[model samples]
Target: MPSAISRFAKFAAIAALTSATVFASLDDAEARRAGSSGFGSRGTRTFQAPPVTSTAPAPAAPIERSMTPRPQTTAPATAQQPFGAQRPGLFGGFGRSMIGGLIAGGLLGMLLGHGFGGGFGFLGMLLQIALIGGAVMLAMRYFANRRQPSYGAGGQGGSFSRSNSMSPANNSSFQIPAIGSGAGSRASSRGNRPSDEIGLAQADLDQFEELLTDVQTAYGAEDYATLRRLTTPEAMSYLAEELGENATNGVRNRVSDVKLLQGDIAEAWREDGQEYATLAMRYSSIDAMVERDSGRVVSGDDRRPSESIEVWTFVRKSGADWKLAAIQGSEQRAA
Candidate 1:
């Protein structure tokens, strides 16, 4: 019933209205978001919207943090020591080494001292001094005099006889022809006879033994000063050197089996205004065990009871008692 041209116009107008409605809906959503942020004008078109924010939040400021110190950590199972303990220091190790070295040095010193002769190399000299010292002491005790001539055996001034069978002047077997003094006559006659004979008083023998005992005690005690006083200077020095060695090596000597077999004054003579007496003695002795710190021995038959001969010549100076001048020892001359 309607004209064709009117229908066409109506259809076009409907299409235009539909497009406008869709545009409006989209604009409403934008406006809602802007209003919440105060960016929208009053009375702007409003509509429901999906949840939204007007401006993206400023990207979170990059966090700035620092690492902090931590407590000691536990050691791994493979470690030998526990946690927090430290190793030994340089000085500690050095101290241990020094202690070990000192111990080794001391042991070596002792071995060298005892393993070799005379106690050891340096110690032998000391032992020699001790031996000489002990020997001299025994000599002093045993060989302090010589035998006096028997009354019936000689015409010496110190002899007296109580028998008529032997002539009172001189025994037939012990003749001393009177002679005028001459150098040749004295040399052939007096020199052949003993220079002189002297008797040993019991008191003299006792005193000699006492002095000798004192010397022996000193030697046993290693008192070198006493030994020097009782013996000659040369003898003292010899002994001192030996004692020094003994101190170094730690060895000592002892003499035993001393017997005063015979002792008497050999002669009372004057030479250069000095009086002297020659004494002869016989005895037996042996080297015995004394000390062995350095580990040595003087090997021989020390207790064999063999005799020895000793000759001790003495000199007396003004204001001084008799002192030993020289001494001689002989194993073959025993008796």
Candidate 2:
């Protein structure tokens, strides 16, 4: 036995080395466990703690959890696709919507025809507005663009009547008035005073009959040139345009059943050393259409005899020679 102090020192040194060796061994074992089975422990043989280790909290339990496969959330998304893309009904589309609205309104009107007082029908209201408004607009536009027609006495083919020209005789049977003959004096007084009244009343009446005969003859013969001579320039132009249109459209109008109803001089006056007289004549005729190619009468407005009244004015350059100046006629269409 050495000194007591020396002996105590040697014992302490040996105890210290033993504790360090135990610590080193525990670290090696923990590393091995962490690398392999992840959780391993060693028993303590003495009063020393098992090991010194970092106190890092154990990795949080994996956030992933067991799934119950809830009522197919993804399946619901697929089921909604077809319904979202489905097309609309016909009446719901833009182009056909107006037609649907009209039909619906009409049907509603029919159902409520008796319910509403005074026969207020939906379709009737719409139709009335359309027709009336359209007619008014058309009439306004036409009147705005048109001027009144003017008439006067002018020479035929820019020349005076010739003495040798053959025409209906004066004082002849053809010269007789169609209406009450000599009574023309009593029918239309030339002057307000009884004295200056000219016996031209008979002459005026005769002039009317002649004018009508002239028109009928010219129309029958399709003598457009002679018709131009008898009618005003405006009237002539209108007829020519009508004929041109008919030709372009390939149509021919036929006439028949010609009858003279009445003829009388409406007025008579003297202008520039010439006698000017206006005649009123009434007549009836049947108009028929003929095919340009077949000569067959196809269609016409005068299936039933149509009546017309013509107002004609004539001028005479000399005593026995007379020619038409202005002529106007109105033909009412048969219903």
TM-score of each: 0.35, 0.37
| lDDT values for all models | 0.35, 0.38
lDDT of 2 at 55: 12
Candidate 1 deviation (Cα RMSD): 57.5
Top model number, lDDT: 2
Cα error, candidate 2, residue 124 (Å): 31
Off-target runs (Cα >4 Å) in candidate 1 are 1-192, 197-221, 241-250, 289-291, 294-296, 300-306, 331-335
Q: Locate the minimum summed-lDDT window of 10 residues in model 1.
A: 155-164
TM-score of 2: 0.37
User: Which tens-of-lDDT digit does each residue in 1-335 have in candidate 1?
Assistant: 43563454344334433433333243234323221111110011111110110110111111011121223558795778743243432212453345334433433443344311233433353353345335433433332211111111111111010001211121111112112122213333324223332333455445454444454455545687777666555445544554565456545545454444444333345555555544344444443333466434543233454343343445455555544443332222332
